[model samples]
Target: MDERFEIFLVATPGLEAPLAAEAAALGWQPVVGPGGVTITGGWADVWRANLWLRGATRVLVRVGSFRALHLAQLDKRARKFPWATVLRRDVPVRVETTCKASRIYHAGAATQRIERAIAEELGAPLAPDAALVVKVRIEDDLVTISLDTTGESLHKRGHKEAVAKAPMRETMAAMFLREMGFDGSQPVLDPMCGSGTFVIEAAEIAAGLAPGRSRSFGFQQLASFDAAAWETMRTAAAPRPAPAQFFGSDRDAGAIRMSLANAERAGVAGLTRFDCRAIGDLQRPDGPPGIVIVNPPYGARIGNKGPLFGLHAAMGAVFRERLQGWRMGIVTSEGGLAKATGLPLESGPVVAHGGLKVRLWQTGMV
Candidate 1:
């Protein structure tokens, strides 16, 4: 219960650098770690991060850690630990535990012990499906406790209820946009946009909108939460007019409708446009050159990979013929698919998306 606690910003693997960069840009000096970036901050910092950071999948506040040789010691320390400072008695909590290289190797037993300690001392109800979660990790006999301040993964965004098959997570889309050096100053286009994730995200970023503005956070239920202060923080950023338009096109009319609905719910419909068109029929918008980002169907998700070559080639032909001076970011699992584009693409880091390892293939002004 220190004034400033360690906050871990979890990122999708292979996307740590961009997330770290974002944290630094937000005035936090984060130390990059295995699965996330760690920074020292208080409860208010946690709230702000959950509200502002688009790349973070979840925010975990490291409450405390202690050396526990056995479950008895763990239970005693957990009972004494200042749970009142973080966990509210009125809210329910779920305790999850992991034991590694320790005598207390039974994760279930350790979870029960911590659960008993919290219920007995803090008077908080324990439930199997509670929004608040206490994560305990016992590694090398060191018990580290953390709280998941992001209830339903940050990707939910509380707006994009309509999703297409093989839809991209908002968190990953944000990071991918960042990777393309999208500062929201220029236009963005998704030729094969499914559910319009990239286009909607770009429009929102251009409007200077907070990703979590439409959502509620788990931190609001914590004991240290200050309602007035949180309200001030969440509404601090005034939405601005986008510099340019964002566009999305899909062959499926259903996908186009879903994109429009999703954009409306995200409050970025004014800055975005969606159409039903095949890649070959896509025409560049009337504006200066911008970035073209698309998450096209891959072999794993959609139909056979054999015929995709022609589709990719057609996409490349359209981009080369119509989208000159426009940069490109293509997310696909197969290198042949990207190569078939014939756009002189250079591969970036490989990312894990929906159980398939995909890479961002980038091309300088096509």
Candidate 2:
């Protein structure tokens, strides 16, 4: 608390250990939680966490947290806190609040009070579409306010300008890879790499790349932001390459092209090879037994479940026939699609993502 650090990493449940591992790899002492990890440090830690944490959805910097008995005390303390340190007077910001076991349980009222205080007292503008968002959580009698230092979620790596239908976010993909026990040295294969997210994220990890290296962060605009310190951190945290071992394939030629473009923009094009081939054609390159992670199309909503069922059935057939000893991770929203694979899968954890409760069904062949 003395360091004024208020950052925590939110991830899929059962992934706290992997997220903690990624944080600790970057010299961050991360404490595991039920669904995430919390770390504390200085203002520079805030910037570095946003830039380097691959497994977190977003980094929330704790601005203020105090015990509040009533709405009056909440408003008073909120006003006294230095909002200017985190918010830019020129850029607009939105206040979002969630209330629980507290006297000020009305969320709208609390949000309005904080919004008015920041605007009238701190001279910050209010915009409905403000990229910078402040989240206030009231639990028990303590009110904790955190700034969403990552404007867009860290998944928006600014590389994949094109998005496929039901395209997975980069952050979610990274978290899934970590959940599958992916280490950087081993080869990674995405048989149905629709947009090449898994392979590209793996390549980035293998190359020691930071996820947010190509994008700008909200913390860069904060009043307390130090330009020289951030530059030094970026220079030091940039990724280095390993062996060429990332591979991805999709049946669609368009997806292959888009994936290639995304890889080029991400500067990991050399690390991954995107192929326009059916799953039957996927072959493991020369390496130790590695991962075969697939986010195959679920016949849930977009397509005909019957035909998509056939697709999942085909994927299962290919996996059973070809991948004898490789570990497999099959992600799907529909349990039936996952079951169709017919592989001996260990029940992985359930995670909320993209309007569906997706589960990662795995077969540990390695």
Best by lDDT: 1
lDDT of each: 0.91, 0.82
Clashes of each: 0, 1
Off by over 4 Å in 1: none
lDDT of 2: 0.82
Candidate 1: clashing pairs of residues: none
Model 2: clashing residue pairs? 6-62
Instruction: Give the per-residue Cα lDDT of candidate 2 at 56.
Output: 85
TM-score of each: 0.98, 0.91
Deviating ranges (above 4 Å) for candidate 2: none
Scored by Cα lDDT, where does model 1 land? 0.91
